[model samples]
Target: MRKFLASIAVSLLITGCTFPGVHKIDIPQGNVVTQEMVDQLKPGMTRNQVRYIMGTPLVTDTFSPDRWDYIYSQQKGGEERTQKNLSLFFSDNSLQRISGDYRPGGAAQ
Candidate 1:
């Protein structure tokens, strides 16, 4: 009986103790970028102009010059389902190549 009581007291004490600290959390959800946005981009547009229209490209290919990659993905908590990704390439200050897991925004619709 005494041991059981001691255990209960210890449990209560542990539960009552609260550590003081601040924690910040980031929550992610499916933020899909529409294909229409990409279609609006035009050749001869400068880097700053492209960014102004399409925000910022997620990945910039370091191996090549005048090439940029844009990627977007979303996954719910924990599931092995495929995530969405988009890639775009630029050359001579214009969009040159685009390929990826997600659908590229087309010029029409």
Candidate 2:
């Protein structure tokens, strides 16, 4: 009887989540890179300074030591997932350029 009751309860919990009215909260993951943060970066800034302004990068490759990738993704309750990418390049421990969806001087692309 206990096993039967447990199975019934489990089924009800699963079905409850499948109900149409069930609400799903927005899910955001990874580095939340922002336009203002990217704009704060300037050529010739040291790697530590860049890290301070932009927060930690989401991706850093050992093979490509000079390149740092910042990635952001969001999934709304019932909508398709969206993503943004930012790549910052450094040479000689100083920032050299920026690339990807975000750029300085304006809103994200």
Candidate 3:
């Protein structure tokens, strides 16, 4: 009886010393624009056309209606964070230029 009780206590102590691993959920925020979407943009496309291709801009300034900013970010558990920003400049409601972290056709300018 004594040996059985001692064995049970030892088992309980070992189990108590062990810790269950924590689980973390992936967090994603803002517009998740892909490269393929940006590739579809053309210089003369209208605002509506740009919206159809890239969805609505994440950040739109009332003071700067000619500029649209698209941003994307994600953080996965125990992994490196990812982020991308794309800005479109317009003149007379037509897309004129693309800038920021991503550029179509591998162009840098």
- Could you say which candidate leads in TM-score? 2
Candidate 3 or 2, higher lDDT? 2
lDDT of 1 by residue, 1-109 (tens): 9999999989978866343443433334343456677666665677778778667766666777566665555443343444556666666677666666544455443
Name every residue pair that clashes in candidate 1.
35-105
> What's the distance in Å from true for residue 93, model 2?
0.5
Task: Kindly list the per-residue Cα lDDT of model 2 for residues 1-109, writing each as its tens digit.
Answer: 9999999999998898778888989999999987888778889999999999988898999999999999999999968999999999999999999999987977644
**For model 1, the run of ten residues with the poorest summed lDDT:** 22-31
TM-scores for every predicted model = 0.52, 0.82, 0.75
Best by lDDT: 2
Instruction: List the candidates ranked by TM-score, beginning with the highest.
Output: 2, 3, 1
Q: What is the lDDT of candidate 3?
A: 0.88
Q: Runs in model 3 with CA error above 4 Å?
A: 1-20, 106-109
In model 2, how large is the Cα lDDT of residue 53?
91
Off by over 4 Å in 2: 1-15
**Model 2 worst lDDT window (10 residues):** 100-109
Q: Write the per-residue lDDT of candidate 3 for residues 2-109, one digit (tens) a residue.
A: 999999999988876354665556889899888778888999999999999999999999999999999899989746889889999999989999998887865433
Model 3 earns a TM-score of 0.75
RMSD in Å for model 2: 3.4
